[model samples]
Target: MSIRISAVAAEYGRGLRRSLDQVIGQIDEAKRTGVDLLVLPEACLGGYLADLSDADSTLVHDDPGPPELSVAGPELAELAAAAGELVVCLGFCEIADGRRFNSAVCFSGEGVHGVYRKVHQPLAEDSYYSAGSGFAAFDTPVGRLGMLICYDKAFPEAARALALDGAQVIVCMSAWPTSRTGAAANLADDRWTKRFNLFDAARALENQVVLASANQAGRFGTLRFVANAKVVGPGGDVLASTGVDAGAATVDVDVPSELAQARRFMCHLADRRPDTYYPPHSMLSVS
Candidate 1:
């Protein structure tokens, strides 16, 4: 049950053709290295927001924002074909039911396995894209997989839901940027960078599920990204990481064995007492 996972951190901007080329290149490398599952940053298919300064403003910003793409579009088809046997998870601005969603889609050469629209919207992100409804895990060649977008990982309930749904691994795609104010001179010293890394470990440790985190690198518009992609073990251990640079955190881990070892005695999910939870969403159910 050993799986090879690659958490990718790279630059993706407004050019659709360039973005596709960048992702395809990574896929080519992963294929050569025998990666079973590859997770790319949020909005890697198009790009992320130009700036967070006016997200809270009701006034429509002049910037057009990330180009919206359908889950059934040709871009995804092209990625699927390039994926061949590899399971690839990537983010995009999804247009569905007349609303745009910050979404992630999982697919392979065979076809799509599942899709996740980010349920939690941060800051003024809600002003642009409508939030997703819930969290769910789907079966894949790698294992039972759950997906979360950028800010969704900030909420413990999101990851917990997928764990309860039998997810062995969680793919968290993000376009997280450096601090807007009191900006740190170094990327690694940035407080937001620490939180980005902390959330990845915390979610994995608490849920006893392997976590694969990917993020955008470089800068786009008024945002400068913190490219700290990583793969974390169920025990809160950093198995591999790309630091604050643009690259992939690649690792070979035995999923079931790690989960079993970590949960040998203090199984977080099994030990939960849902009955004691508060009335409103303390113990929510996807059913």
Candidate 2:
């Protein structure tokens, strides 16, 4: 069966209120296009408020009873309301155990589905958030959906695990920096120059799963992110691409077809020889 998804690549560093408003607007557009799911850029709710130059004073606490409903609190409700009959994946700064984490939360017809904390936090992110333990894929009406916050997509293992866990579609949310310099702009676009190829093309080819990515745009305190939002097919085809920064685009995808072709050609998982592949410590030396 074919399904449609709307990917929203927006600039969200202005503030919480403004960012959420934009997200709600995007959701409305997605509904108009009959999208099954809506994916937003990382930190869409909180915005990329924390920078490396400033020391982190933000607090993080684990979900005690119900989720904290202060500033970062109301976004969930708004997201749920906007979702209505659709599934959504929204990113934000998470506070837990006195530490901050770059997290992506998924909301669907049944409310919040799952949350994925970024594992590989970059230099700018490291100062503000702690790393996540592992990866997870959620089962939804639109098939099994895998979650990964920006930076996490850099690692192949993360995507591998999600594929192994039965995820047919992988969605990533990121706030990647774009070129604002004179020399860089003349040569190439910073987004592609910094390596959008490896992330979009390689991931789809390796895992044999459709990859959808949402990125932020515009300048947020010296940092710029021009939207390079894309949807890649299993065979490394660029199914749908958006050149501009802000706007909505919809793509009708066949999840089953991609998965079937990937399995037939690669079959990497089936050919694995796990019994003999042990850790170095477990392999005793015969001296």
Candidate 3:
């Protein structure tokens, strides 16, 4: 069966209400296009904060992080209602047990399906929120789904773990920005943008899974986002993309068939050499 999926590369401002309005509008647009699944950028609800300039300075209090929200809060409930039959995946600042997490949630009319906390904290992001312990895949209306938040996509093991857990489609939501230290004049020319695109293709090809990436666009605080949201087929082909602008990359594909075909020749998952290789910690211990 074919499913219509859309990955949104759009600006999410600081206000939560405004963000919800934007999400509602996107859902309406996706509905018109018969989109079965919609994926929005990381920190799409509360908006991401400025880059961490000081890794060790506790006195740096000028920029507070995004607002902490509960998974069962009214905001997510509203989004779930707006989603209706359409499956929606978006990132948020999750608050639970008085702790905040850089988290992503997937929901539909039936309510929340899955939630993922970002495991890999780049820069000083760990100062703001707690890191997730592991990666997991959950069942959704479209297919077996896995979610990654921002820097989590940088680590190969994260996607590999999810794929091993039976994820057919991996949705990576990012609040990625251009080079912070020496940014290029044009956003498209930025090196980080290239890495973002390369990672998407590599993860999909390696895992033989459909990969959908949604990223923040426009400027927020000191960061200038690179909105290169796209969907990649199992063979690492760019199915649809929003380039470097604020828009949605939509595509229709038969998920199972595409995965089967990609793995038909060489199943990377089936071909294992885990015992022959050294442990990740042991390898890190070497250098």
Candidate 4:
């Protein structure tokens, strides 16, 4: 009942093809190391930028076409093929029916398995991206794998939804931006000034499940996404983490027993009172 997880912090703001190659390399490396799962930075395919003014204008879509039925779409095949024996989770901009959404697509030897559109689009994101309506979890060989994007991790309900849905592994793809003054750049200690944030710990503590986060590295124009990729176990302990620059980390997780034990102790899922809980604002009132 072990889950071998890996997180790849790729160089931020690189071309789609080059970044895909790096991600493939990470997948291959994970395969060689017996890692069962691999996660990469957010927007790994489309590049982590609000707009692709810098990239060839032809690729940038003012009006994105229809959303591909699956990750097997022309743009995502190579990545899906490179997933090999491990499950790969990576992010990309979704072009669906003349609308665009920030999406993360999961690929495995079986092909596209899960897709999650980012729910909590941040302030700047509101201008360029549309918010996703809900959250979901999917079944996998390792366990129930949940999908979440960058800003979605900030919301407690996002993880709760997954946990309630019986997800054992919470996978997050983010491209968090840093300050411009470079104050975050010279942070020396983990106390007051830290490179990595606290979302991973919070999410793990709340859900009591393995939390894996992959973030981009380097500055995307004015945005600075200092790579901080890591994997947190069911007990909210960080198994492996990465620092600045493009790098990768891996960890083996004993998911089944850990999840069972955590649930047995806390028992959040068992104690849920779904029948009694009701929202005041409802389209259809339940009597």
Better of 2 and 3 by TM-score: 3
Instruction: Provide the overall lDDT of each model, using Cα atoms, as 2-decimal numbers.
Output: 0.92, 0.73, 0.91, 0.73
* Candidate 1 lDDT tens digits, 1-287: 79899999998988788989989999999999999999999999768877766763323445667888998899999999999999999999999989999999999998999999999887778878898999999999889999999898999999999999999999999999999898798999999999999999999999999999999999987789999999999999999999999999999999999999999999999999887776645546688
Which 10 consecutive positions of candidate 1 have the poorest summed lDDT? 55-64
lDDT of 2 by residue, 123-198 (tens): 6457656798998798887889898877777888898899889888899887877543442552135644347545
Tens digits of per-residue lDDT for model 3 on 184-263? 88888899999999999999999999999999999887678999999999999999999999999999999999999999
lDDT of 2: 0.73
lDDT of 3: 0.91
Off by over 4 Å in 1: 56-62, 280-287
Q: Return the lDDT, model 4, position 47.
A: 72
Clashes of each: 0, 7, 0, 5
Error of 2 at 224 (Å): 1.3
Give candidate 3's TM-score: 0.94
TM-score for each model: 0.94, 0.85, 0.94, 0.83
Point out the higher-scoring one by lDDT: 3 or 4: 3
